[model samples]
Target chain A: MPTLLEIHNLSIEYKTRLGTARAVDNVSITLDENKTLGLAGESGCGKSTLGRSIIRLVPYPGRILEGEILLNLDEDVPYENGVVEKGQINLLQLDGDQMRALRGKKLAYIFQDPMTSLNPMERIGKHFVEIIKAHEPDTPKEDAQVRTKDLLEALDILPERVLDYPHQFSGGMRQRVMIGLGLTLTPQLLIADEPTTSLDVIVEAQILNLISDLKDKFNLTMMLITHNLGVLAETADSIAIMYTGRIMEVAPTEALFESPQHPYTQALLQSVPDVRKPDRKLSWIPGSPPSLTEPIPGCMFRPRCPHAMEICATEPPPLMKSTSGGIVACYLYEGS
Target chain B: MMGKSITISGVFIYLRLVQESFRDRSKLWWIVLGVILGGTIALVASLIILAARSNSGLGIPVVVGTILFGVSMLVVGLFRTLLIRKGTFSPRMGTLFLVGVTCILGVITIPVSIFILPAGWFDLWTVFVMGGVAIGIILLFLYSRYSWLKERGSPGFLTITGFLMVLSIIYMTVISYWIVPYDPAAINVGPILWPPHPGFPLGTTSLGQDLLSRTIAGGGIMLQVAFLSVLICFFVGVPLGLLSSFRGGALDRVLSLIMDAIFAFPGLILAIAIAAMLGPGVINMALAIAVVYIPSYFRVLRSQVLTIKELPYVEAAKALGARDRDTMLRYVLPNSLPSIIVVMSINFADAVLTAAGLTFVGLGLPIDVADWGWDLTFGWHQLITGAWWVITFPGIMIVLLALGFTLVGEGLNEILTPMLKE
Candidate 1:
């Protein structure tokens, strides 16, 4: 199957008070058509930054130093032209006006913090109408209002609730409103960055189920970035394990969990306390990830990796395919 | 006993909060307190000065001594904050100084009032000399403490208060005319420039007329200009600003450009130009002042509108298909109030000063008229010939009134702007 999206040798940097910090370095990942790719890492481990960069939404002072996010739509397939064109456009090169056209129409994002994303002063219904109008300016006002009502209903929000302000809605309801917006245009790829982080556990489960049902209904391909291992196991088809600005492991969900090849991956899996088998002691990674400023002398994880050896301290580890059916970046897996 | 002590401690804590709020160092409570205290003292001293005309009374030196004490309090309030900022005085010490200022000013007023009584009702020469010395001492203290207080109170407050104070003093002068027997412009060439005596208090002006009556009548005219100018400026400026911000694009740009051009020139020059064309009167000066102020309000409203317009809810409203006018009026304007108020308070002061400036420079209301600016302009000449009462009294009144308005405006701004409180 052809790759739906390919990010090759990507590196992102930000100019800060404490020198240039390399946020994402040499990260290469691919997702096939109709498949889900989960990018998992600790907070500030460059997971959200990667999701934003893929959609060309990274704010100022940080730029893609080197990389290409090639989003190749299957051109021969006959699909809704709007959804097709949304995923087909080269977002990195478009100017603000052109990029704006892509937002809410073709390519859409469900931001992490929904509170600030919505305007506090205006009615929710009014915001919904604007997104439609911004993309389809010539659409009659009556049609836009009707579609807004339909979208709100689809998200399980009462149509009357649409009249309320963003502040009036609860955390869960706002996230659903955001999801409803992304689904309105039926965009091909939905980039959700921890959409349920602020929500409660029950709300998180409902939101996850909503995403699953909607993705299936719309046949949407998604890139879900989250720090929760459980969410990724349940929703993601394949998982990319990231550490210190690089992908340390990438494998099918079951394969990565059942038989992880990298030491870091093993450490991460061991850290999750198994409720079914309550006797297991949760293991920690022992030390923090190496700083991204300046070049690390050797393997970025050497200081923290229990399996670190003499050679691992001098030469940076390169990712290699393992016989166990996943990629791992460790000197022990070099020959594999 | 233990319970009672705890209750007492809790009560003390509550009282501290209230006092701290009202007497906040950042809010410049001392200056405000000082001004209020000083004004009360000055009013009492003036009355006493007039009332003492009948008795042998305190001499000019004694009145001057009282004036000096009040002046010191004003100086302390103004400079106390500056002294703290510069490390010359710690905050606790500053508070002590403020308390001292209030007490001292209150004390000094007792004697100062005796000299302010009507001439011959007291020793008239002694009252003048005493009042002059007091005012001089106050000015000297304020000058010395100027830099210190500058760090404490806002210039915006000073600006507004100064303008209102001058207007109030002028109004009092006009009202004083009503209290006296003669009109300000009344011709009585016979008893002109007769020096201080029982019936013709404050002696005669260079016009050989009753100075007291003219000073009293000038107050009403000043009231008319101050109130009218502020009203016109607010009425015109606020709406023009709202319209420009809402319409934006070409209209916003044009409104801003026109306003910028008007604001570029000195306000008095603009008023003079308008007066020259419209001919000299309070109405023309007011119209000119209104035109100049429109741009300031427009600028404030425009920035506020821009911030409120971009909020997500704003987009939601647009999405809901709200008309632009409805969105602006119902949403944008209300949220932008604190800023609008801050600007208006400052502008009120500006309008007053601009009107006074125009009048003083001969581009506004004429000098023969009974107005504060007119009184000060002609009265200053009398000050040179040892006829200090002619200008000194009115000038001091203007200064005190301006300071009062400024203090109030400053307090409001400080309390309203959360960012400035700490």
Candidate 2:
């Protein structure tokens, strides 16, 4: 199967008061259709930054130093498959107007805080209408309204509540409303950044289920950015582990869960509380992720890695194909 | 409290009834009710006594109508705590107690005014009215204390009370016009410094004209000048401020520089310059005052606009394809209104004062127009002698009316400032 969305060698930085913050550094990932890729990282590990970079939502001062977002729309065209077409476009090369045109139709985003993402003054129905109107203004207003009402009903919200303002809805309902809005366009790839972080456990499960269901229904290639290992284990088909703006490992979910090669991945797995193994001591990942402002001489996790050696401090590990089904960027896993 | 099931629906129903009752009461109807029962009787009895002394039935209806309107307004106001309320007055015993007390006070004041002021016990009516006003102030103060302690955030009652008092004073000024008939400008070569009489009420000016006529005419001039100047200032200042804030480049710098230069100009001196340029008249004086006020309004609006411009909503609107004009007008302009309203009021009072000062210096209107400043100009000399009412009345009127505007502006500011609202 062809890769649906390819982000190659992406590096992003922003100028902050404390000097240049290397938010995302040299990250690469390819997501295939009907596959779920989880960008798992702790806070400040550039997971959100990487996700935002993919969607081109970086506000200001944050510059994409080097990258190309290559989205494969050719697969949808019957005759263009496996052909090197002329005038192949990259997303970064597109202007703001072009980006906006492509964005809700081909690319969509699920923000973490749905409350702030939405206009508080407008009704939920109005928000959907505006999104549809922006991309497809020629569509009749009455038609858009009906479609949005139907989408709201599909998302388990009452159609009567479509006229209610953002303030009238509960947080979970708002998130669902947001998710419905993001998926209403049926974009090729959906970038969801911590979509369930703000929801309760039950609501989180419902939302995750909803996203997964919609992913299959829409045949969406989803890039789910999250910190929760359990969430990734449940929802994502594949996982890319990140540590301080760099991907430490990428693999199929079950394989990675069974045998996590990267030291950081191993430490993350051990930290998760498991009810099946009640006697096993819950492992703690000692030390914090490396500060992005300072340059890492070799491995960013060298200070925290339990099996760190002298060479690990000075020489950065290159990502190599491991036997178990994926890639690992670790000196210890060179033979795997 | 004893046996009531105070459900949400019950509370809601009670609140609805209270709102309905408040909206149903008309200000005119309340005033009419007050006149038939409260102070009109006293005015009629006084009119009869005055008729016996003068042996002339000269427009008793007009005098009665004026007194009826003014006194009944107060009587209705005293009762408005119950009758003219807007929101829920939930059947609290404390509210009932307040209503009862106001009714008692209104009843007592009626008989007291009948038996007191007209019987050469003027001090009694003064004391009664002052006492009522004092009690209102105290109640307002107590309400403020409660609101502060309760952390309700807004001084809502205090604002309404302040607004009521200013409104009443403005009503008083407007109603006073009904008592006079002769045009204030019609020259009278009657005896100068004539004492109070039926023919020459409020005595005569040094010009041998009715001071009452001049006072009435002067009020009209002051209002016109203030109204016109403020309107012009708003037009010139608000747009310029919005322009500077939204387009912060060379255009902004140029607008700011011009405004600063204008702001640096002395108000009186600038009035004098415009008056000198255009020649002294009400129109010229208003133009000068408006010109001087523009800079102040511009500075205030520009600063407010700049602050609002930084807010995220502006960017969000821009991102949503809201045209620059649409964003500035819809988002930035509406948000900046409170500050603009506040500044305009202060500038209005300042405009009035400036016009008065210019006229007093013989630089505003021509010598014939009965402006408050002109009245003060011509009346101040009479002050050195024992003709104290000449300068005092017009001066007091200017100061008191300006104070009324200030109070109203402050009250409005309390309501308009979203950050300050509860």
Candidate 3:
């Protein structure tokens, strides 16, 4: 499988009042072509930050310190006018305009909060026109609106709803509208950041199902960020557990669920409450994840690791192949 | 508590409220209290009128009635505000400020009337009492300006102002032209200072120019100054604010600093100062007022843009390949417009008042231009000889026009409060 995105030693930091906190540490991640990569973590574990960085939409006061995000494209990217681009573009090096041109067409972000994700004053169809005309300025208003209505119809929303403002839609409908908007330009990659976190159980299931169907329909390679292991269980192909700005484990969904490596991954799986096993004892990992502020030279999950060794406090773990058939960033995975 | 809605061309509509907050109030208590307070003021004023019965300007009943009416309005506003503060009443902060502002202006008319009218129209004691009340209203307004703007709770005030504004707009745009019997600037059309009669409906000015025509046509320059000033403020303030906050860095800091510096001064006083420097003409008067108002629009828009540019939709726009220009124009600008509109309304009212203020201070348009400010400027002298109609009419127009824009501002505060909260 060809790697669609490769983040090489990416370091992102927040210049806060107290100190510089590394939200995304010297971490490297890769996504294969047409694959669903679920990035799961406890709250504030930088999953959303990583997703935003890919599209260069990381807000101010947070800086990408040192890194290279190499996007290996099969076709010419949506490069800025007067610029030409082919395969293997380093996203970090692209100018602001060039980076912007590549955003929606090459990759789109379906943000987390659907309630505020769309413009309140704008009608749903104008939201589509804004994005469509933004990328392709020559697109006519009628053509853009027609495409939006068609997209609305496909999302199971009434095409007429596009004429209505965002407040006129329910939460689930708004989420669907957001997804439809992201998919409007048929971007190859879509990053769903906690897409269902704000929704009810029924709506969450529907949205997850919608995302998976859309993924296959659009041939999208996705980075699904959420703390809900259950959501990732059904939707994602590869599951990655992130803790304190570091990826702890990455494996095929079943492999990680059945034979999870890394203590954080195991603890995460243990926390998922299942309805099938009526009397199954539910236990959670004790001790909160460590603060990311200031450099901590060791495995970030050491304090919470029940299987922590003295060496785990001093030695930062390196990601290595585990017998479970995926990568695991733990001392246990390395040879003795 | 019910409102009447009138829609114009299916495009423009605003709610005209009947005195909603006054109902279901410990209504009897306030009305009784108001009557007591007003009765007391009127009684004192009546005594002063009797003591100084030599003046032939305003009658005893008229003076007593004006005092009674003003005091009652003041008492009603204070009562409603107090009830709302206790959380026993649900109406927001609208009418309280309205009544306070009206009383303050009503108090200002005292000095104007005294200085303009025949000597001793108001006795010394009467001046002292009115002056004290004016001070109190001014203090209350200063104290509540922030919170009052946040919510101008319903009363018939908005509706009253709305209707006034609509009427004033019609007068300026349509009725003025329709009703004017003679050209305003045409001199010797009738005898000088001729009292309103069947032939010359509003009589004639000192130059024998028809007073009705002059009063009707007079507002053109004032309106022009106000509209043009607001336009300048919008064009300069909104774009600069948008640019500053959107591309934030040193430029944002600098622009914000300058706006704040301008804002630190009193609004009308600053306009007067600028108008003094520029020397009055049409564009110069507009420019003077625009400089005073730019900071208001700029600060409002800059803060709105700062918050709005970070909204999820704007971020989404950026992620969707929107350039800085597209995101600002399509996403940020439209979202910020509602706030700008509220500001613009407030600005129009302030501009109208400030333009009048400048003119009153002799820094407004040239005296020959049939301006209300100029009319008021010169017309006041005639009040001593009992031709009160001269100053009275233009003053009424000025008040009504200012109140018109002000009503829109207050109404919009209520209308947009819900949308703004979300």
Candidate 4:
């Protein structure tokens, strides 16, 4: 499969009264077409920031210092000078209008908080119509209405309820609506930013199933940002563990979970509650993730790494090729 | 180099803005209403001039017929469009249309009663009967059409009281011209210090002007000043508030300093100072009232915008690639309107009182114009002679109008705040 999106040497910093905080630091990952990558991290670890930066929508007080977000439009497309090839557009270099046109058409975002994501004043159908009209200005209202009804029905929502306000819907239903909205234009990439974080366990499972089903049906490339390891274990084809504004490990889901190489990834696996291992207590990683405001001299996870060595404090670990068909940024894999 | 492109883009942007605003069907009626209002004013002014100069006696009926026809057309058009949008009649829209029609008729009645009405054909009793019957018919029509209003219970006590008070003010303003047995400005029309009689219900003023007619006529001028001043405050203050809050830093700081400086002084004192400086006229009085009330609006709207700008929906709009202009106009502005509306209603009461105070101090409209404040000032000495009607009736009208606005403001606050929460 062709690479759908590639991020290289991405760094983002947020200016605060205290100082500049490096929210995302030198994070690089490649997502294949029709593939789902799970980004798992604790709170304040910059996972959400990374997801937003992919679309060049870093909020105020934050700036993307350096990065290249290359999107491949098609598998067989060739790059040409000055002309935007089928799949070779660098999103970071695009102007405001170009970026706007790209969003909700080439890519769409599903926000974290479903309750507040929608405008309170607008109806569900109005939201859909606006999105459609913004991109396809000449599309007839009836066409948009038909599409909205079709999408709502596919999500098991009543087509007539499209005229209802967001407040009229329950949390899980609103989340489904959000998903439906994200897929309205059938964008190539769907960025779900902790799509099920606010939902109940059963609803979370159902939403996860719906997302996977949609992915298969549409052949979509997805980046699912969540802190839940169990959710990632079920939904992701490839998993990338983020720690303190940096990627700690990137591997296929099976390889990463079965033979987790990085100490952080291993510790993350141990923390997951298992039904079979009733006697085994969940072991937690010691110490908190390093604050982004203060620069870490070496590895970001060094403070919490049990196998920390003297070199780990003095020298930054480079992402090295591991024997288990993945990459790990740790001193343990430096020589191997 | 940049200036040239900026100007070129600016023209296109403005054109696009006009195009988008015109696309909204509801705005078309406002434009039509504005044109009609201007035409009516021109027609009425010419008719008034003709009546004052000629003995033909044709100008009054022409004015009356034209105004009646125009107003009825406006009402019919508004109701048709409103019904088309909702597909069912709404009590709120009906009430608004009725109020507008009443105001238009009231203004027209002023000239009609002065020149057209026969000497003894119409009186206060006749006006009351006509008004009561009109109101009854409207209520019956509404009740039959919207059965839900009856089932939903009686709205609220404050809301109903507020609605009735406002309706009464409109009624008074409309029928003031034809409701009196004698002209309100006719001196020596009755005995001095006369108490309430069948001909002069509130008795006659010290000048022998009918107190009841004077009180009724006072509604039009008082309401006009209050509404105009509040409107000026709304237009001036709301945009400044939205801009400063949206574009903070230097602009916000400067605006805050200016508004705070104005806010520090007592509203009435500031209005008095401004009114005294501007000299006595209706426009000057309204301008004075508007100047004092602007800071209140500025503060209310700025705070609302500050909070609303942080909502997740605003961020979502940005993520959806909506421009800053679109986000501000569609999301921030609409979300902040309910609170601003509540503030405006509250300020309407303050404006009426302040305008009256200015008039009482001889800085309002000329004494020839029938104004409650002017009547109060002229009737002050009559109070000593125990001619209570001279001062009492005008004073009551002023208090009643203010109370009406206050009740409406309070009721709107109750209704709108919960809707915002939802």
Candidate 5:
């Protein structure tokens, strides 16, 4: 499959009273066309920050220091001149207007908390209409409302309830409404950042199923950022395990799950209690992810790695091919 | 212990009445009957007092008609009290208390809104009477239909009264010329310092200009200044705040500092200085008052923007490729509206007052113009001479107008505060 997006040596830093902390290090990721890429990590693993940065919406004090977010979509090339190179567009170089034009249209993003993510004062239909009208001012409000109804219907929500305000909807319905909003524009890439974190298990399943169906329907290249390994297993085609702002492993879901190469990925997979294997004891990785405020030499996960060696401490391990048909950043995978 | 229940709020007393009356061995019908009886007696006493107070006695129908409506409210209150005593009422005593209190408030506003109009202005008097009756009926229907109307989230007495007060002033301002018996500026229209005698309602000023005509006409210019100044402040300050907070950095700091500098001065003193500098014209006075109020709107909107922009919805909007303008207008502005509304009503109250103060100090329209501030200031010495009607009527109009805005502002604040949890 052709590469849909690629990040080259991306670095994001957050300014603080103490000092600027590097939240996302020189991380490189390649997302395949029409494929779901899972970015899994613990909380504050810079996954959400990384997801926000793709849309150039890093929260205050946090910024993209250096990165080339190449959007490889072959479409109308929504760029002026300099940002486009040989068909692909470097999103980082686009001006405010160009970058925003791609948002909600080519690259839409959904947040974690559904309750607070929708504006309380605005009705669900109004939210859709505002976004549609913003991009296409010629679209009549009624026309937009018709499209909103169709989208809501697909999400299993009553289309007639479109005029209802955010507070009127329950948590699950609001999330569905938000999803409908994201899908209304038929975005090329939908970055869902912990989209089901706040929802109950049943709603989460329904949302995941809805997303899977929509992904096929829209032919969308999705970036699913979540800490839930099981969620990634069900949804993502390929998984990229992120630890301390660096990708420790990148492999197909089955390859990573069946023959996980990176110790961190193994530790993560072991921690998930298996219902099928009743005798298998659940495990956990000891030691917290290190503070990003201070620089650390060599592997970011070296201190937490059970197989920590002198070589792991000497220098940061480069991502290399592992026997599991995936890339691993652990030194133990060298020449594997 | 009883005093606690009787504390300043009449609502608490109503609640105490219901709870205490429950302890009485009287039947429900008897209790309701007693309230109707009491209301009749009170109505008779007010009629006697009003009938005796009327000098020409021709205003007896208007007075008698207004009091009869007030008595009908006592029946409405008893209906609500009994409704609350039924299971349909929310178990919260606050809602029950609000129902009883609003009934009392409805009755109270009838007298207060009525007394302000002199007996002779039949057209003006009838409009207020009809308007009050219409509102009371509509409200009674609404309150009876929806028990949720008594919820804490609902608008309270102050907001309702404020709406009436403000609307009446605006209505009076609009139809003043059509309704006024004489031209507001027409001198020698009545005897000087006349005390609301027949043919000369609201008495007459020292210049023999009709005080009722002057008071009614006075509203137009004051409202114009208040509305214009508020418009200017809203246009300038809201944008400044929105831009500063949304586009924070040097702009936020610089704009916030300028607003703070303006806010640092005493409101009246700043208006005085500005009005003094600008000199006396309607536009000039509006500009002067606007200078005093822009900082308030700025501070309010700026802080609101600061808070709202941080919310997830704002970030989500940004993610949707929304332009800065869209994010500000669709997301930020709508979310910030509650405080904006509160500030606007409060600002209007202060603006009109400041305009009057500016005019009082010889800074508004020419002295011969029929403005409340000019008439009040010019007629101040007449009050010392025991001719209270001249200053008193005009003074009461200004107070009522200002009070109208204050009530709306505070009432909106109470209603909207809980809705905006973020």
Candidate 6:
């Protein structure tokens, strides 16, 4: 499969009253067409920030300082000046109008909280109509309405309930509506930013299943951001572990789980309780993730790493290829 | 030729559409009612015209009979609708009927008193006392059975009280010309500084103007200035506040600085200064009061806008490709309006008081104008002469008007703040 999105050396920082907090440090990621890349991290570990930067929607006080988010697969390259020979278009270089044009049609985003994500004042059908008409101006109202109805039906939501306000629906139903809205334009990339964090476990499974089914049906490349390894294990083809605004490891889901290389990944996996092995005590990593505002000099994970060395305290470990057909950022996997 | 045919066919088509819309069995009653109403109006209008043409003694009875018949039919229709459709008497409908009747009586009596009554048939105080009693009866009925009165609890009671006070002032303003025993501006109508008499009621002022007439007429001018001033303050302050908060940084800082400078002074004193500079007129007084109140509105609305702009729904709007203008108007403004309304209501009382103060200091409208402030200035001298009615009436009018607005503001605050929280 061809690479749908190639994010290279992306950095984002938030200037606050305290100081400038580096939310996303020189991070790099690649997502192939029809593939699901799960981004897993502890809370405030910059997974959400990285997802937002993909769509250039980092909220106030947060700035994307430097990055190259090359969208290689969009059919129409409206601006010809910066198109590479390989047909990759850098999203960061586009102006506001150009970015808006690309947002709903080419790259869609689903926020974490379903309660807050949907506009309370607007009906569900109106949300779909607005998004459709905003991108495709000449699309007839009847066509948009029909499409919205069909999409709602596909998502297992009652099409008749499309006229209902956001407050009328349950949390899980609202999330389904959000998902339906995301798929309205049928974008190439759908970034799900902790989409199921605010739902119950049962509803979370259903939403994840719905997302997986939708992705396959539409042939979409997805970036599923969450802190739950179990959720990633079920839905993601590949998993990327992020720590302190940096990717510590990236591998195929099975490979990363079976032969975890990075200490942070290993500690994270150990913490997940196994029902099959009841005797195995759940092990947790000591100390919290480093604060983004006052980052330590060396590897951000060194203080928390059980296998930290003197060199780990002085220098940040570079990402190196592992024998397990994946990359790990740790000294232990230096020559492997 | 083609244009004439098209126009004829267009009229036919429109008529057909209207017929089709009323074809349903459910809609037949509406058509019947419309026809009945149209016929009644035509009959009454023709009778009035005949009366005017003939100049006969039969005209008065015919006109009165037609009006009474129309009124009876309306009452019957209302009852029928209530009993048939709702199967119960709704308190809201009852309140509406009462208010309608009151308005009709006011309309009838005001014109009749102005045009038909002999100049000295009755003292102006008699009309005022009668109107007050009728209003009191209606208010008592509302207090007991008005649905919102029960639903809104204590705030609702306050709202009704405020509403009634304001209504009385409006009633006085409207009927002032017809009900005043003498024209408020007419000097030497009686002996100067006379005690309360059967005709004068309140007494004669220093200029021998009827104090009762002056006080009633003064309400009209007072309400006009206060309402206009509050309206100006609202228009100037709300938009500026919304714009400043939405487009923060330099614009916001400048607006805040300007507003603070204005706010730093005592409100009445500032109004007095502005009123003095603007010169004496009703418009000038209103403008002065508006300037003093604008800062309060600005401060209230700016804070509300700032908080609302940061809500998740606003960010969601931007994420959905909503333009800056759409986001501000659709999301931010609607959410912030309740606070603005509350502020405006609260500032109304203050604006009235400020305008009166400016006038009392001889900076408001000219002394000849029948205004509460001008009356107070004239009446103050009579106080030492034991002519208490001169100052007391105008003072009471000012206090009552201010109290009415204050209650309304407090009531709205109580009702709106909780709704915002929800």
For each candidate, the DockQ is 0.08, 0.11, 0.40, 0.21, 0.34, 0.16
Regions more than 4 Å wrong, model 6: A16-19, A73-87, A119-129, A136-165, A309-315, B1-150, B419-422
TM-score of structure candidate 2? 0.69
Q: Sort the predicted structures by DockQ, highest score first.
A: 3, 5, 4, 6, 2, 1
Backbone clash count for every predicted candidate, in the order shown: 48, 0, 2, 3, 2, 0
lDDT (Cα, tens digit) per residue for candidate 4, span B1-422: 11111111110111111122223336565575345434433432332343223332333344344345444545554564577568675555666665666565656555554565557334533453345433433343333423322221222234445555665566546555543445556778778768887556678777777666677677777788888998899999999999999988999999999999999999889899998899887678789999998988899999989998988778777766676777788788877887888899899888888888888887888666777897889789788877777787788778877877886687556545533312
Report per-candidate TM-score of chain A alone.
0.92, 0.94, 0.96, 0.95, 0.96, 0.96
Tens-digit lDDT string for candidate 1 (A104-216) = 55456787777665655457787777667656667888898899898888778999877777667878989898888777767767888888888889999999999998888
Fnat computed for model 5: 0.68
- Find the candidate with the highest DockQ and give its number: 3
What global local distance difference test value does model 5 have? 0.76
lDDT of 2 by residue, A1-336 (tens): 877878888999989888898888888888887899999988989898898776676767799999888887642211112322323357787666555555666677777876555554456787788767766668999999999988988899999887777666778898898778777777777888898888889989999888888887888889999999899999999999998889999999999999998988999899998999999999898877777887679999999998898888888888999766999998886765
Show pairs that collide, candidate 5: A104-B320, A298-A316
Cα error, candidate 6, residue B291 (Å): 1.2
lDDT of 6 by residue, B277-354 (tens): 889887888898899889988999899888878776676566656667777876777667767777877787887788
Cα lDDT tens digits for candidate 3, A1-336: 899999989888999998888898877888999999999998888888899899987777889989999987666655556553768888889888788878888888888889998877677888888888877888888999889988988899999877677877889999999999889989878998899999999999999888888888889999999988999889999998888888888899999999998888887777778788868788898877777776667887877788888888898989999988999998886793
Q: Candidate 6 overall Cα lDDT vs. reference?
A: 0.75
Pitting candidate 3 against candidate 6, the one with the higher lDDT is 6
lDDT of 5 by residue, A1-336 (tens): 789899999999999998888889889999989999999999878888888889988887998989799887566634433332335888898788778767887888999999899887777888998888866777887898899888888999988887667867889988888888888889888999999999999999999999999999989999999999889999999999888788899999999999999989889889999999999988898988888887689888888989999998779899999887778898897776
Specify the highest-TM-score model's number: 4
lDDT head-to-head 4 vs 5, winner: 5
lDDT of each: 0.66, 0.68, 0.75, 0.75, 0.76, 0.75
Model 3 CAPRI quality: acceptable
| Regions of candidate 4 where Cα sits further than 4 Å from its true position | A74-86, B1-155, B418-422
Best of the two (1, 4) by TM-score: 4
iRMS values in order, in angstroms?
11.8, 8.1, 4.2, 9.6, 8.6, 11.2
